[model samples]
Target chain A: MTEEPKPRRLTPKGRATRDRIIEAATELIARNGVAGTGIEDVRAAAGVSGSQLYHYFDSKQALIRAVITRQADSVLHPDQPRVTALDSFDALRAWADAAIERQRENGCRGDCTLGSLAGELSVSDEESRTDLATGFLRWKDLILDGLRAMRDRGGLRADADLDELALSLLTALQGGVLLSQTMLHVRPLEAAMNASLAYVHSFATTAGR
Target chain B: MTEEPKPRRLTPKGRATRDRIIEAATELIARNGVAGTGIEDVRAAAGVSGSQLYHYFDSKQALIRAVITRQADSVLHPDQPRVTALDSFDALRAWADAAIERQRENGCRGDCTLGSLAGELSVSDEESRTDLATGFLRWKDLILDGLRAMRDRGGLRADADLDELALSLLTALQGGVLLSQTMLHVRPLEAAMNASLAYVHSFATTAGR
Candidate 1:
C-alpha cells in the first residue's frame, strides 16, 4: 500500500504547473467534494487550459490520486519535524489541542482533507479508496510508533496493546473532526480527543492509576 | 433546525408518490452522494417521470432535505422501539455490537447515511449543514440520555461529565465507521468502540477501580 507514487521526470517549470493543478483540485475537492468538483473547475481555478490540465492528469481520478498523495503527506506530517515526538502523554494532548485549535482557527469549516476525501470517494472509487486506506494506515502507524516509544521508555505499561491504542486515537480524530465540521463547532472535536487521551492515559505507568 | 418538514396535505396515493421519490433519492444519495445522484437518476429509479419528480421536489436541494429528514429518523431510531432503552452499559455495548454487526453484514460498503451526507454537504450547503448538525445533536442526545441513566443508577461516578462521554462515543463511532468504510474492514470500528466503551467504563463505580 506504501507503493511509491508514479514518477514523473518533468522540468522544474512543468513540476510547478502540475503542483498548481493539484493544489487547485485539492481546494475544490475539499470545498465541493469529488463529485461536485469538475475537471473544468479545476482547470479554471488553476488557470490552465483544458489541454494543459490533460497534459498532467489523464483523468479526474488521476488528479484525485495526486491530491490524495499530497493530502496524506500534509495531514500525517503537518509539523513534519514534531510528529515523531508524539510519545509522551503531554505531547499527545498537545497534538489533540493543536488539531482542535486548527479547526477553531478555520472556524471548523473544512473537514480534515483526508477524512472528507474518504467520505466522498471511498464509496465509489476503488483506486482512490486504496490510496485513502494507505493514507490512514500510514497515519495509524505514526501514532503506533509513538506508543511503542512510550512503552520502550517505561512511560506506558509494557503489556498495553499499542496498536489498538494508536488506532483509537486516530479514530477519535477522524470522527471528532467530521462532527466538528458538520456542527460548525469545536466542542465535538475537543470532547472526542479528550476521551481518547484519557483512554491512552489509562495505560500510563504513573499517577492516574 | 428541528422545524417540522413542510406541510403537504396529499392524498394517500399522492403521499405514496412523494415517499417513493424520497426513498429513491435516499438510496441514490447513499450510494453515489448528493452531487453524484441527479434528479434524473432518482426519477428513473422511482419510476416517475421528470414532471412527477419535479412535482414532488421543486429542486435537488429540496429533495436532499427530504432525504436528510428520512435518514435522521432511520439512523437515530434504527430499532425505533429500543432507542430510548439505551440506558445500561450492557445496552450500550449491545448497540455498538449491533452497529459493527450491521457494518460487517453490509461488507462495510455504505457508510452511515447521515455521516456521509454531512461529509459531502456540510461544507457548501448551509441549509443541509444545519439539518446534518441537528441530526448529530439528536444522536449525541440519545447517547447522553443513556449516560444520564447510568449515572442516576449509581453505575457511574456522580462527577463524570456524561455529555463529554456521550460525545466521545459518538465521535469514536463516526471516526471508526468512516475508516472502516474507507479501509473496507471492521477493526477500526471495533477498536474505536472498544476504547470509547473502556473510557465510559473508566467512570464505572466498582470492580476495575
Candidate 2:
C-alpha cells in the first residue's frame, strides 16, 4: 500500500497556499483530465512556485491522489450527516434530488468529481486506482450505513440484501451521472436513481411503509 | 453540423496505411486519453510520415472522431444483429452475459471503449460529444427495439414505458460498467444488469412468460 506522504506543519499562510494549489489543480484536472494537465499547468493556474508545489506534494501522483481525496471530501462534506442519517425513503429521495440539482446547476457538463477522475486514472496508475476505489468505498459505506439504519428502523425487509442494494444504488448513480454528463441532461440521472430507489423499495416491509 | 472529411479514393496500400494510422491512434488514445496522446505520438506509433498523417486526417480532431466511429463500430459489429433481434428475454440475458464475459476477458481494464472516451472528450470537444451521444443513442435504440418486440409479442404490458425503461437500462449499464472497470471486478456490472433485467421482468405478461 503506497501511503500518501505526510506534509510538515506549515504557517496559516502556507496552509492557504497549499489549499489554493489543490483547488487550482482540481479545476485544471476536472477540465482537462489528469494526463492532459501537466505540473506546469497546475503551477501556472495555482500561481505557485515550483518549490512551493514541492513543499506541499512530493510528486505529481501524490498531488493527484490528494485531488481524489479532496474531491471525495467535497462530495461527502456537504451531505455527510444527511447521507448517513438516511432513515427513510423520503430522506433517500431528498439526497438523490440534491445530487440531480447539483448536476443541473453545473449544466450537467462534468460528472461526479471522483467519477471523472476514476474513468481516466483507474486504467494507468495502481496507487491512483486504489485511492479511487477506496474513495468509492467510502461513499458506498455511507449509503450502506443509511440502508442499515432503514433496516434497523423496520423500514426495509429483514431479508433485504443491504450491501447489494447499496452497491446497486451507487452503480446507478455513477452510470446515471456519466450519461447525464455526456448527454448534458438530467433525465438519465433521474431515471437511474429512480430505478435504484425502486429496487430498494422492492424490499420494503409493511412496517417501513 | 460538422461533416467528416471525404476521403479521396485510396489505393489498397493507401487504405491499409489509413487503417494503420487509425488503429494506432485508437490504442494510444485508449491508454493515455485524447488530450494526453499527441499527433506526433500517433504518427510514431503508426509509423506514418507527417505528410501521410495529414493526408489521411485533416487534423488531430478528425483522427479522434474516426477513432470514436471505429470504437462504436467495434461495439456494434459483433452484437448488432443479436442486440437488435432481442426478441426474447433469453436473448436479453445472453446479451448481458456477453457484455460481462467481454469485461472479464479484458480483466475489466477498459470500459465501453466509447464510454471511456466520452468521459474524457465530452467536456472539451463539442463534435466528439455529439458523436458519442449519437453512439449511445444507437446502442439504446437497439435495446429499445428488443423491448418493443417483447411488448408487441405480449411479453410485456402494453402500457410499458419502453423508452424510459430502455434509457434506465442503458444508464444502469453505463454505471455498472464504469464501476466494474474502476474496481476491477464484474460484480457491479452483474448487479446492474440483473436489476435491469428484473425491471423488464416486472412488466412481463403471462403470454410473454
Clash count, candidate 2: 2
Candidate 2 structure quality by residue, lDDT tens digits, B1-209? 26866446988899899989999998887566676689999999999999999999989989988887777666457545556577688988887888889789988875437667766777667898898888778877877888998898888999988877787888877777777777888888887887777777777898887
Looking at model 2 chain B, report the run of 10 residues with the lowest lDDT sum: B75-84
Q: List ranges where model 1 is wrong by over 4 Å.
A: A1-7, A76-78, A207-209, B2-8, B75-82, B207-209
Model 1, A44-85: lDDT tens digits are 999999998888888887888999898888755546555667
Candidate 2 per-residue C-alpha lDDT over A41-144 given as tens digits, one digit per residue, 9 for 90 to 100: 99999999999999888898888988888876664675555565666899889878878897899988744366667666666666878888888788888788
The model with the greatest lDDT is 1
Q: Estimate each model's TM-score.
A: 0.91, 0.89
Report the Cα lDDT for residue A89, model 1: 89
Over 4 Å off, model 2: A35-41, A44-47, A78-81, A110-112, B6-16, B35-50, B78-81
CA lDDT for candidate 2? 0.79
The numbered model that scores best in TM-score is: 1
List DockQ for all candidates: 0.69, 0.54
